[model samples]
Target: MTGIKDVARAVDMSTATVSRALRGLPGVSDETRVRVMETARRLGYVPSPGAAALASGKTRTVAVVVPFVTRWFFAAVVEGAEEVLRDRGYDLLLYNLGGDEAARHRVFETSLLTKRVDAVLVLSLKPSPDELIRLDHLGRPVTVVGADVPGWATVRIDDEQAARHATDHLLDLGHRRIAYVGGAVEGVLDFTAPAARLAGYRAAIEAVGIAPDAALEADGSFTVAGGVRAGHRLLSAPERPTAIFAGSDEMAFGVLRAARELGLRVPEDLSVIGIDDHEMSVIFDLTTIAQPVREQGRIAAQQVLAALTAQYWVPEQVVLPTRLVVRRTTAPPSDG
Candidate 1:
């Protein structure tokens, strides 16, 4: 039954000052803020979310829309965003669209409208013009993670550059016959990641005066199973590639699995590299381009929180950096 009044009395401050301090609003000195927080914690005075929402016109909740919660990148981003939101005395409302068009439509049309959140953080799901309009109608500040959307705050890595760097690494290792494993070239709307990555791979190959061959490209769909299937098709060719550049570490792992099934030694027979230094990448010894996936999520969450608190309202794009991680899976082509 402890309330803000009890904390205010313990801290010898007015209810307004206690509220401001708890809500992290300005006009409260750091000393006062700390004292109020300590007193509130000591007294077990928890602010009622409903009461706070009614008083401040803010639900103190952020809605996160993602295509797939089960994926490593999305899961990591969600964890990072949740950490920041929880520390800021806010809650997270998750909406997993499951990468299905119908599910995505239902979420934007119905689920989002019914949610009482102050801001929305979309992860890796590019909203079309119509979907964007619908989101704007929600009247909540929106922040996107993964790709830049005009007129909205975004935090993302340069997917094309990351893919190019991975490809260049293989090229530098004297890999003339380098194959690419990524998502399908077509059959999706509002999703440009696959195309961007494919472009990067081709750019790297062409920069080296090598004609990009469609035969060397296979659609992995950004999944382990997809990579495994792609790997079989690529390796079954009469003249297989000396190195494989997978768009994701999961796919690279799948490639590794397929190589083993075909009695191919990594680096010796087929060097493999990938993007996203996923947690399992170490176990797989995958050479990859490491992007700050969780950090991007955290930054996106911070942007939405800033908008909700009236701290930052201007929309901006934030592009994080990626690094080439040299691991056991990548090496100079045996022919070299």
Candidate 2:
């Protein structure tokens, strides 16, 4: 089998220099790095992951923590992170909590203690104080997605601003009785997006000199079925809202279904808007605030890599932009 020594001999470089170049370590000149790579390729020499780990004390693996792997947003983020990790010659370790408290506990308490990963990338989870302390004990680089954490790298959208944008669009269409469907559960430990979005919804209405009504706020649980339930409850009221702002496109899809079941015409009798331009949004004709879901994952992975490579790296707090995507579901209220 071809080896590093053979490549180093072919390139007339020291084994240490070749090793440094191959591992992408600093202090190697660009010209020598390129030559070592070309010679290694010519000799078909492949570095063993175990040997690399032994040399650098790095596992060459990153762990990605998600609430549920089946969800669209989580799945898309994992796909994007995997792409970057694969290209950078790293392996991914996935921790799927599945919304189970025991599973979440086992992951943060025991599983992460195994030292199997060099870094961690968390998705949408606001860990408890104990959990955060446990993660801090790991002494490894950690990057969070969809939530902000102190002293850690984060990649997320401005949830409050995005929600405000969605509500403002409805208000501009003369929707005074706008109903908000969100995913928050009271007295439950969860992520921060739902609360931030709910605040934004209230802020938009209050800005226009309107008092926010608790009756119009429905918990959609960030799912299509939940949206359907919320939709029915809101539509059945004596004074139904002409417009609804769902926290996610999945919920918006449910609202559309509910509207259809109730024999109402979209944009004629009712209009709806949502956040996250989900893959199925086009089919649903959902007007939404489009966020770069997959891009957030890619950026989080890049952050992990940057921390791994840099000797003195500062944790980054990256907030991406969201834009309103006008589609067939939103329009001026029929009365207007």
RMSD to the true structure for each prediction, in A, is 2.4, 2.6
- For residues 207-242, what per-residue lDDT tens digits would candidate 2 score against the true structure? 999899988999988889999999998988999999
Give the runs in model 2 whose Cα sits over 4 Å from its true position.
Answer: 1-21, 27-46, 111-114, 186-189
Best by TM-score: 1
C-alpha lDDT values of all predictions: 0.87, 0.90
Each model's TM-score?
0.90, 0.89
Worst 10 residues of 2 by lDDT: 183-192
lDDT of 1: 0.87
Candidate 2: give its CA RMSD in angstroms: 2.6
